[model samples]
Target chain A: MSGSDRTASLSYDRTGDVRMSSSRVVSLIARREILTRLKDKGFIASSIFIIVLIMGSVVFQVLIQSGASNVTVGLTGAPQGLSAAIQEQADIFGLDAEVIEYDDESAARAAVQGEEIDAAVIDGNSVLVSESLDDTLGAAINGAVNGLALARRLVDEGVDPTILQPVSLDVTALQPAADDAEEVGEKALVAFVSILLLYTLLIFFGQFIAQGVVEEKASRVIEVLLAAVRPWQLLAGKIIGLGVLALAQLVLICAAGLGGAIAFDILTVPGAAIATVVQVLGWFLLGFTLVAALFAVCGALVSRQEDLQSVLLPMTLILVAALVLAITAGQNPDGSLARVTSFVPVLSTMVMPIRVATGSVAWWEIALSVALMVLAIVVVVRIGGRIYAGALLGKGGRVKIKDALAAERVS
Target chain B: MLEFDGLRKSYGANVVLDEVSFTVAPGQMYGFCGSNGAGKTTTMRIAMGLARADAGEVRWQQRPIDLEVRRRIGYMPEERGLYPKMPVAEQLEYFARLHGMNSAAARCSATDLLDGMGLGKRSKDALEKLSLGNQQRVQLAAALVSNPDVLILDEPFSGLDPTGVDALAANLAERRSRGVPVLFSSHQLDLVERLCDAVGILAGGTIVASGTVAQLREREANRQLRVVIPGSDGHWARELGYAHVDSAQDGVVLLQLDDPSRDQDVLSAAMAAGSVAQFGWRQPTLVEMFREAVAA
Candidate 1:
């Protein structure tokens, strides 16, 4: 719209214009923050680093898992059917075993000592080894040898050995475990990943927002901004802008991690992983808003960048505590500490996500925790906004929160 | 028209502004003159809605200035500030948008303002890359980018070189011609004397004196006269009984008149003594008026 048309309308409908202009101001500020930060080398580097870290971890795990499952077994003068039997038994045990024939026991022993093969089976009656054998490989070799012996006995008794097929009884529990071992492991992984991502992002974005607020104050840009719009608008714009950036980075990292895990067949349950991502993202919004508001207040409390660390210490400690609680929740998701702290606002941002991921939290618990966090966010934002406005124009090294609140009342 | 009607502000037990009242009518350039800690910045902040006035309001066209009107007012705070990492042109555009201009209009305004300030080539450069003088110009451009209806700048001319000052003066003059009311605070009295149509002298949290320059001068000027008698002793006015000599140097005597109506009589008395070369009522400059106002 033309400047004249806008100005005319501004005066023509005062009440309506106020509502429209505030949002416009906030968006303008938010856009500036986004554009400016996009050019920052630090922002780009951190984002790239996180994505590579996530993908790299997944690839490394896949390699380790593949390498761990492979086994090479050496044989010396073993029966023809024995190699095939060993291969079939190893397959049942989920091991990829390769049996290689040797001219004699000495050669097989020498191969095992050289570490080329994991172990050796010498004659049909005896199983050979270097140092010791793993239980899975031992069981596979034992089962093969016993079956061969039993068949020989049947032949000696003039019975049909081909009809002597092996059988095992089917055992079932009335009520199985809620989560299988693999599912529990998957959930634990989700808990760890979600917590780590949330912790790193919350801290990164919290500092970004705080430093941003201080940058304005130190540069004295707040004066010009406050002239056109209210302090709350500036605060809101900064939080929303940085919050979106933080959320985007979180999503990118989660998606890359999830995609990599699935591609490499690392994650058994993809749905749970996706749900964890959603929960982390949802909690992150509330968490960032809560912490970002306080960070802004802390930033306003100081007039210089050098003083930021001291003022930020308390909030940083709180975040660190949450991080610790989140890790503990991952290990003991149903523990009393995790359960109780999952309802606390700042701590819940971390603990609740882990609890949810690990399947220890009920739907009502999540809802109540979310509601409490939302309430805390509302109160924190309101108070923080006041303190921010009060201390924004204040000059000096440090301002007490009490003084800022008092100043806010006067203003 | 912008009116700051009885704006009062206080910090703790100390009052920074006490019923500080003044107005800049349309097309008028009002100069705010005060010593250090005289509440000039505070008054301007209140008008811009950057600070709250405890007991009064800043009204425009007899209406209290709300967010809409505040966005329309161009304000440059005493503390000069802009995003140092932001490109100069983009920073100005952001400010324009904050003042309620749409993106396209804001862009146009920012580009034009930057070019007008001779910063066209450097518009793409970060603000911090510019010299302090150039940065100051960019700050001014930010204030003017929205083509504001009212202008309130605190210490706008401080630290500017002569060329920069002239550039700013011209910009302000153009705005004044376009029916915009401008209020700027400055320690530079001579520039204020030459530029502002009305002047307000604030001291001890109050406007001690404020009016048109001529009106203030007239009010503060003592009933004194200066007469140059080339061939007579300078004690002629004292001997005439209607006036007494205030000072005398270089054959010209400065007289403190006992009455305003006796000026012609004194002139006749000077003619009776010798040939009169020069005679006029002595008026004080703005600096003198300010010193006296603050001192009082």
Candidate 2:
């Protein structure tokens, strides 16, 4: 037989049994999604921008903390005993103060302007400052200068300076000590960063899923894809693929922030901070799955990219509401509202992580929140998959969500 | 053999396909023709498993075609879709992998298909960068990359130029020579008539007429006769007393004879009037047959 004739007969055998494993097909689709987005210049550039912002925040926090450690006072025409009195007061307040004497008030003013000293004790009793001092530092300087002026006045009035010396009063509080207060501040910062990360990641990646779906539908590629794989597989694969990308970007930004904090010695108790990060990452997976599924469904409802915004409005609103609630809840982690929201399914993904990072949340609450999130994810996936399969191949204008839900499943 | 049997589908109260059925044997090219909304696309979509039919099944070699079976069938949708931002070869390879080919095999197949489509140099170019015709070629290559057992294309010739049409025809011919059953829909009836082994004409969601191209022409010509005589305006056909006269022009008359046995009398009358140049019956073109099928 001729070559063509032989090949014709050979094709009969080729038709028998050529099926791929399900997971393999899903991975192939997932890989395509990842590669396509990774190659996109916009995705890459935005990822880098976020990392820089994270690192920048870390650096800013470090600079503010280090600047708080020292107080320098430039002196002009101060009394002979004033310097010793100021030193005594500084010791009492646990402040490190450096005294520099200049020739005149003008020189002291110049020194303050040049940042040679934080404040200047000009003409003995008047305090010259370039800007407003924080309450604690201002109080320390006022206390020292006032005490010396009182002593000098008593001596001039022919009264004994010892008799006029004020008694030292000590006060104690039931609240946490200074170090504990600093720890509280750090915890709040951690929670704030955690919420910010969750909000941005969820929003960014959620939109990624939506835009990806619209691209497929708008380009008419969904038909070809629907032929090869089940609708659920395509939906799940896209979510998982973009989820992986989002997680990678999140990890990089978080690592950059953590590394910056360590390098600048800004973060104390690094182990605890790292634990908070790990918890945030865990909650991110739940939050991402819940939102990504809805995004896909919304994406399928619109054939044009411009129509996506209207269809996605409800999802965007929900995410924004979650974020606002989470931020308000972060301020009072142990409050009743925060505690209540922590167990709510969609809200928990945003609230529970912040509460866990900042306060001593009960283990049962965290477990319950996670369970609720998982349940929500399951429900969303079922409904979202149906809508996606129903509306994906629909052409011309936008498909109504109600119609899509009512339409029969394609598969 | 690929068989689309008793397919029925409806959107809301409007029926898109009602009892649309056809079969294509291995190594044969079947042409599916229809006007807009005649269920040509719906039927192909059902066969590819992209859409579910309300009632009916697509079977391959006596087994119902499912996801696994669809993976082995190449399908080009009516509205061609590919990732505009994806590189040509990469997208094809991606599709091949989705169809169950190994990564290495997919890569090789993608390159081979692109090279065959005269897109070898543009393999790395994004799909959007290519001209519309080249993009269409890439879409076709994507369908063929898996070396599918059957090929189903909807309007594969729609946006193609003559050269593109020729290239696509050559590729499809090669597949057909390998015993691959190819079913495609097109409005270009001449191309369908020339290339297809069998033709199915759909109207109002039903298969109005279907058979081999020759068979359909012969069936349509059975009742119709075209008579031509030299030096006559073809007015002699009016004297035959046929109930229907299709047309008369250029000294030739096309008639639908109520009694075909009367053809001899008609021929004698024409000969008596003038020397007969062409008196044999004429075969209807695919376009003519499509109109007649849809009209009926």
Best by lDDT: 1
Query: Candidate 2: misplaced stretches above 4 Å?
Result: A1-19, A72-181, B233-236, B241-245, B248-250
lDDT score at residue A271, model 1, on the 0-100 scale: 83
lDDT of 1 by residue, A1-411 (tens): 112222222221112122346677778778878888899999889878876776677688789876777789888777768898898899999888999999999998889889899989988877677788889999999988887777778888999876787677798989675777677777678667777778888778888888999999999998888877788998999988997888888888888788878887778688877777787788888898999898889999998999999999999999999999888887788999999999999999989988876755678999999999999989988888889988998888898888888774322
- Candidate 2 residue A255 Cα shift, in angstroms, is 1.7
lDDT of 1 at A226: 80
Q: Give the lowest summed-lDDT range of ten residues in model 1 chain B.
A: B231-240
For candidate 2, lDDT tens digit of each residue in A1-411?
012232233333433233577777777778888998889999888778777776677778878876775578888898776677766677677666777889999999999899888888877768888887756667776777787787778799898767976678887787744346556666667667877878878878888889999999999998899889988999989988998999998888888887777677667767777887888888888888888998899999998999989988988888888888788887787899989988887788888877876667878888888998999899888987888888987789998867778776656
Query: Cα lDDT for residue B137, model 2?
Result: 85
lDDT of prediction 2: 0.83
Kindly list the per-residue Cα lDDT of model 1 for residues B159-220, writing each as its tens digit.
89998888788778877777889999999999999999999999999999999999998895
Every model's Cα RMSD, please?
4.8, 5.2
lDDT of 2 by residue, B134-162 (tens): 99888888888888989999999999998
Candidate 2 chain A weakest lDDT stretch, 10 residues: A1-10
Chain A vs native chain A, TM-score per candidate: 0.80, 0.77
lDDT of 2 at A380: 84
> Each candidate's iRMS in angstroms?
6.9, 5.0
